[model samples]
Target: MKHIYTDLAVESKEIYNPEKKKEIEGVSVEVADEKNYSVTTVKVLNQKGSQKIRKPLGTYVTIDVPNLDKTDEDLKDEISIAFAKELKALIKEYKKNKILIIGLGNWNISSDSLGPKVIDKVLVTRQYFINYNKEFDETMANVAAISPGVMGLTGIETFDIVKGIVDKIQPDILIAVDALSSRKMDRISTTIQISDVGISPGSGVGNTRAGLTKETLGLPVIAIGIPTVVNAATMVNDTMDLIIHSMKEQAEIGSEFYSLLEGLSKEDKYKLIEEVLSPFMGNVIVTPKDIDVLIDDLSIIVANGLNIAIHPGIDIADVNRYIR
Candidate 1:
């Protein structure tokens, strides 16, 4: 069946709310804020909730910050700190210290460059740990990261590459970062999702590959992402809905046509809209024109977030001093 493609659990919850009861089975939502960022955490427990949400049974945390598309130094720092702190809280239960960070995307493509960009900014400590066979400094952790070029470039599956590395490094926890697609345009580059549900490379744009999960890789997996694009069909459908809503609000009350429009089910509307747009723009992906700037700024936010989360002894201030 045709449905909106979104990498956000909160959005999935929003979609399932009307159909389910007061609460979804095995699903919980917790919300908090950090400065200008709105952090939402969704926990999907059990197989039922996993099936309903179309995500694995784990916690998914999303941080929504304002003006991410625009360049603002102060706002970027705030988001980085917030993202890092939230990431720490999510991974607290995992006592493992050896961390392997996987940056999943093609750096050559700006729109898909989020993972590799962040990888460049990440503070690597694996060599230091491996060399000395002991902790080097108070601010460092056994952190290592990689950016395996996409399958088309390397001709190797993303999961396979990560699996090979995991087998050799034997890290306690695995963190994967990627660029995702959203159903709403406004959400692009403005939202970050960190989850323990693992991840499927290329799943954000519908080309789902193998997933990197604990069961598959023999270790816990943490996935962090920011939506950078939107499906054209989904965008068109939402626009049509907005237009319908505007027409209904302006049209005379009790009109036959307005009532008829109101009576159309959401599923019917989405399907009809997708069918109409599929012929022309089915595989179209929409991204902001200023994505070049957004990617650079976002990489810092995400890289710092991962740094603070992976290294418990260091905070954002310490990271700033170290990076500088």
Candidate 2:
């Protein structure tokens, strides 16, 4: 089978069962359709499920908004509210505890800048809590945020930096945000994945880093990611599939060309495409032309959701008033 590259568990599940017919052995999936978006939850129950999906044993919630790239203020607000609802469910136990938000990515590149951009918009109140030494309200939480640059710029592993902060602050919960890679073009910037399995920084781009997980950090780690790029080979393979389907439609039922097209397995085709492109492209990545605007909009959407989820006192209106 072709090694499908995707940072989404839902996509991995789909790749496991393209027909979406029968159930996997140890995996459970539930999907819900909301007003403007859809939510798909994939839970890897044990080692069996983990091996099948190539994902850690945890809950991965995917939010798909078709119009995310072209969203207006109203749609952004709606998406943020939906995001907050899902995020709130995951961290309900630590709502009032000290929380740390780590934005993991390079801010210099627009396609890889989702994390840092979100940090700029997120509401940080940890300093205020420390200075005054009192809770302003029952809904308030001590929230701190940081955007740790990549190793190339700082000469330090992201995990080391995060571990140092975690040791010092001793937060009850940690949330890490980063950009991801998708196998499909339409999913880029239109999908948000919230998982309890934590994250491996730069893994989507083949730059795997040490993961920030419960075992490594000694706390519950939540990961929120948005797909900002897609592999060029995957995109070309999809286009070839479409072209083959179109050609097959015009061919006679019993024609040799039809049979040949039908017999071409996705794995074989993808491998052939990869072989053809590898020399020149060398793992080329493709992102939308309007990535700057997409990054800007997505950052606000994620930040607003984090604010509303972490700070119970905040809402869409409150976040908008401050962020916008």
Candidate 3:
């Protein structure tokens, strides 16, 4: 299916169907799987809700294999071993000398903390392998990671910060991890995309971070991410769900075997309605009571994917099987 997007005012709007072209304002919306490089706004603010500071959003996949089962340390171990194997393969590509891991995100913001969080956990094999306490030794370390905060504080552009860092350290490869946004909520929990092409930290939002692409960084760049937020249009979808449920209760709407929501109090009714329509709410940061544990469980799975992606010698078949 093709996705059509339009911008109205400061916000961008989107419609997946070309048939909705007449429904959308401004240009005629057409449906095509491929995107026009020039057409930036794929979707404008289709629906409105809370006015939060805008942030660039996309989907990211995170994996953490060890925590698969509460008591199953064996499974976790197996996952880790497998992950190590896969990562080793990827690492072999960087036979060239230096590897720099750039954790891209604003550490201050909870929504953008993925990059920094994962960076802290990375196991720098070179650091521990050969015990040494010398400036040359540290400088010669194969892997070095940095979490360059958002451009807001540093006065310098992201590209410039990376360039300065690069000039000083000179690494062979760059791997960046950051949070992203997704139009669909189902993908929020588990979706990791790795690409050699670097990333634009705040492109989804109006504030564009200096991009860290192969062209800009002058090195091979790999990006890993998880979707941290959903847009307001998803909120509109949630509201419509409530409206539809209310409409469905009307006799004119469903007269045959009336399944009316009659005896429940206002609070109870609202709760029930919300429960019934939760799935339509895209990328919900809030988890339902029943799904809370499940969501938490998935976090480990995502972290494992990232672990395997970075470590370069981990076999992830076991990890992939558990997550799948």
Candidate 4:
């Protein structure tokens, strides 16, 4: 209900691969880059029930999408379309189900609050769809949006806040959004992840609030997030990247390795080098001692990605052209 994101940048919207299929058979994870990026697929096999966590990539679409100078509104349009597409497939199985979009996290803490920023830009369609369908027939219409804030002096648990809303609305589906922590730093501002398993608000930190998952909410829950925060471990990872490149430049076998390395993402190359040079770094941490700005920008990117995923129809060109 509270609109939190400020310093709006409409032009930040970027669709790296418009031709890319919005939904794939499995989730694909990717790291951002100027040219090529890294994509990884995680398999979660021990899950049960009607709901399954489809892919680790579910939480990382925006990182794969290119372009950033976009406004919240533009990104919202993108997010809406993608959400609709995803829901459309789900609705075919459960026509009677209601849909709730919950944005999770605190609005005051900008870096840790991608959910609030995205919720602010979402275009509420429940009322609009109902009115539009009365005159013009349409097949879809049940949806709602909410942001379950982090526990503060309010003492409100995310589960209770979301549950209370769900009790009244009786939605069939719940899609929650929030900021996430990553093992890497460059990934901070470049990743958007989605999942059906819901999320535990503030879990990235030591504060693990009540979970808002499908099992608890008694609805099909989808979670969307971005890695707004990076752990100190990633700094160690980044340093290895530099060391490999430095070592490669000075070795006889370095030329061929350097050529292959140039084509690989910083993450992938780091992994390869790590396997070969495991003896050197027994255990270390090299990332920056500070993470304030990194987290701030990551939150914004995720907020924008959530908006874009739920409302993909927005025209960034129009906004950019008009603003200029």
The TM-scores, one per candidate, come to 0.93, 0.96, 0.53, 0.57
**TM match of model 3 to true structure:** 0.53
Please provide, for model 1 over 1-324, each residue's C-alpha lDDT reduced to its tens digit, 9 standing for 90 to 100: 566688888878876674545788889988886557788889998899988878788899988876776788778777888888888887889856688988999998899999999889898888888788885456677888899988999999998999999999888899998999888787899999998879888877889899989899999898999999998877876787677778888878655676676566655666777788779777889998988989998898888777777776767786677762
lDDT of 4 by residue, 252-315 (tens): 8657876675556544544554555557663332223333454444444443333333343433
Alpha carbon deviation, residue 232, candidate 4 (Å): 2.4
Model 2 residue runs over 4 Å out of place are: 253-255
| Every candidate's lDDT | 0.83, 0.90, 0.49, 0.50
Estimate, for each residue in 30-63, the C-alpha lDDT of model 2 and write its tens digit. 9999878999999999999999888999999999
How does model 2 fare in lDDT? Answer: 0.90
Residue-wise C-alpha lDDT for candidate 3, range 1-324, written one tens digit per residue: 111111121122222222334334322222222121111122222222112112123211123222343435455445444433433444456543566777777777666667766666554544643355333332233567778777776767778878888878777787777766554444453334443446878654334567887788787776655555554444344455456567666648453333444333333443554455567863234322333443334335445555555544433553455433
Candidate 3 regions with alpha-carbon error over 4 angstroms: 1-97, 125-141, 238-324
For lDDT, the strongest prediction is 2
Overall local distance difference test of candidate 1 = 0.83
* 290 Cα displacement, candidate 1 (Å): 0.9
Kindly give the stretch of ten consecutive residues in candidate 1 with the minimal lDDT sum.
13-22
265, model 4: CA deviation in Å?
20
Candidate 1 vs candidate 4: which has greater TM-score?
1
Best by TM-score: 2
Order of candidate numbers by lDDT, starting with the best = 2, 1, 4, 3
